[model samples]
Target: MSNLLKVIALLSLTVAAPGQSQADWQSHESILGAILEQVESNLRHTGEKYQIDVAPLDRRLQLPQCDRPLTVARLPGTRDLGNISVSVRCEGTQPWSLYGRAFVRLSKQVVALRTALRQGSLIAPGDVELVEKDATSLHGGFFNPEDVIGKPVRKSLAAGTVLLPTHLTTVKLVKRGQQVAIRAQNTVFEVSMAGIALTDGEAGQRIRVRNVSSQRIIEGQVISDGTISVSP
Candidate 1:
C-alpha cells in the first residue's frame, strides 16, 4: 500500500476508544473509506496531485448498524475540494443519515501572466509564466503557456493573473501565419490556390491571404482551419 493509504489505514484503528465496542454501531472507518473513494474517482484523469483528510466520526453518536450497504456522496455545490460536505446515508430497516466533512487539496501548474496587459494585446513569450495553484480554487477551466501565448487577451488582466479559455480570443477557423487553401468557384469552373494567412480569421470576417503562386495578397472569408474561400 502507498504511504498515504497506509497512514489513513492506521487511523482507522485509532478512532473511538481502544476498548469501545463497535459491534452494534455503524462502522465509521467504512464511511470514511467510501468518502475517500468518491473523491479519488472524481480526481481520476484530472492530472492534479491531491491529499485527503476526513474528520473522525463523533464517538458519542449512537449510530445503529445498517442492514443494507451504506451510500456516500459529496453534497451538491461542494465538489471543488478545500472543505467539502459529504452525506452518508443508511436505507436499511431503520433509516439513518449523517453529514461528514473532508478536505481535499489539489495542486497543478497553470499558466498565468508575468505582467499586466491591456485588452486585445497579443501575448508574447515573456508575457506569461507557469505557477502552481490549488486546482480546487479555480473555477471553470485553466490554461497552459501554449494555449495562451501568441493569443490576444479578451480583457485587461493584472500581473500574476491565471489564464482561462475565457480570457483569450483565438482562431476558431484560421490562425495567423498558417498555410491555407484558397478556393474560388463559379458555374463554369473552380480554381484553388495555396496561400499564407496574414491574420486570424473567423466566420463571415474579412482576412488577408497571400497567394503563394502569384505572390499577391487578397481578402477572403474563413471557411475552415486551413481553408479560405474568395469571391471571384
Candidate 2:
C-alpha cells in the first residue's frame, strides 16, 4: 500500500511539470510578441508607411511566466527605419530581459537608369526614370530626378540600378589654366576682374585663381561656368 501511494505521488508531479512548462512557454511568447508589435506600431506612426519584418523568437529559450505585463523599449540611438533591435523586460517576481531584431522598410520613388550608362555619360531626362523602391535598402539613392539631371556619371551603372550621390558628379565649370570672370562684392561696392583658374572646379566649388590685372592669387567659389566669386 505504501509503495503504491509513493508511485501515485511521483506520477502526479511528472504530469503537472509539463503543464507548468507549457504555460511558461505561452507567457514568454506573449511578452515577446507584444514587444515586437510595439516596435511595428511606432514605425507606422512616423507618417510614412512601413512594412515591418520581425525575427521569430528562439524556441530553445525558456522564460518563467510573468504575472504582470512586460515592459518594451527601443535600444539607445535606434532609428525608425531599417534593421533594429528592441529590448524587452519582465518586471514580475521572476524578472528577465531579451533583445529582438526587426526590419522596417519604407517605399519611396527614386531615380534609376532606364538603360546601361557608361562612365562620364551625361544624365538626361530620358536616361532616368522614377520607380518605387524600398528606401531603407537603397543604400543612399537619389530620390529627386531634378537633383541628378545634367550630372555626369562617375562610373558605369547597370540598367535598373538606382542612382546614388557617389555615382554622379556635377559638370566641371572651371577648368585649369582657363580664363574666368572673378566677381567681388561688398556692402558698398562690387568689382569684376579677369582671372586664370589654377584648378579645375565645378559650380559651387572653391578653387584657386590668379587675377590678371592685380597679379594676385586668390581663392574664390565658382558660381557658374567660367565664373568665380571672391569675398571683399
Candidate 3:
C-alpha cells in the first residue's frame, strides 16, 4: 500500500474507535455524583435525613478520564456533618486526584424547651418537647428526655430554645430541711431510720443529716431522692 494511503487509514481508525470520545475526558458532574454517593454512605450513621451539596468545580479546568472506577473518601479529620471535603481520585491509566468541597446537613430530634424557664427551675415533661434541628449545629444533641428531666436550669432560657448540657445543672436528689429515709445496712443485715437532711446534695454527695429518733447529726451519702445511706 502507498505510505500516504496507510497514514490516512490510521487517522480514520483512531477517530472511529468505540467509547474513545466518552473516555477522553472526565466530566465535573460525574465526579460530583461520585462524591455525593460516598459522602452519603459515610454519613449514614450520622443521621437519616441528610442533605449534601457539592460545590461546582472550576469551569475552565479539565481532567483526564480514568479507565478504572472512581473513588471518594473523606479528608483526614473531616467532621461527621458540616462543611467538609472529600478526596476524589482516579486510578486509571491517567491517574489524578483532587478535593471536592461540600456542605453536609443532617437532621435529628433534639430536646427543646416548650415554655420559658427561670433559673433554678426543675425540668418537667410538660416544660420540654422534642424538636427537629440541624444535627451538625447541635454538636452534642440530646436524644433522650430522661437526661434533662428533673434537672434544674442553670439560667433563664426562652421557649423553643434547644437544651444543652450547659443549660442544666446536676440533679439535686436531696434538699436541706427535707425529710429523708436514713438507712444503714450490710450484706447480712439492714436497719432503717428516719432523718432530716441538713444540706442539699446530689447522688453520691455526702451531706449532714439529723437522726429523727436520737436527735444525732451525722454525715451520709445521698443515694437517691429522699434517701441517704450511712456507714459505721
Worst 10 contiguous positions by lDDT, candidate 1: 5-14
Q: For residue 61, what is the lDDT in candidate 2?
A: 53
Q: Per-prediction TM-score, please?
A: 0.58, 0.76, 0.74
Give the C-alpha miss distance for residue 57 in model 3, angstroms: 0.9
Clash count in backbone of candidate 3: 0
- Please provide, for model 1 over 1-232, each residue's C-alpha lDDT reduced to its tens digit, 9 standing for 90 to 100: 2344334334433234445476966777887787788777887778778888887766545566678988888788886578877777778776677677788899888898999999999999899888988887787445568776777899999999988889988745788999999999889888998999999887668899999999899999897668888987
lDDT of 1: 0.79
C-alpha local distance difference test of each model: 0.79, 0.79, 0.82
Residue-by-residue lDDT tens digits, candidate 2, 12-130: 22122455756554354585578668887776655656787776665545666666887878889988778777766667766666666677888888899998889999998989998
Candidate 3: tens digits of C-alpha lDDT, residues 1-232: 2344234323322222355564576888898899888878877775368888888776644567668899888879998688887777777766677777788888888899999999999999999888889888785757888889888999999999899988988888999999999999999888889999999999899999999999999999999999999995
Give Cα distance to truth, residue 2, candidate 3, Å: 54
- Candidate 1 or 3, higher TM-score? 3
**Model 2 CA deviation exceeding 4 Å by range:** 1-29, 45-47, 58-62, 75-83
Best by lDDT: 3
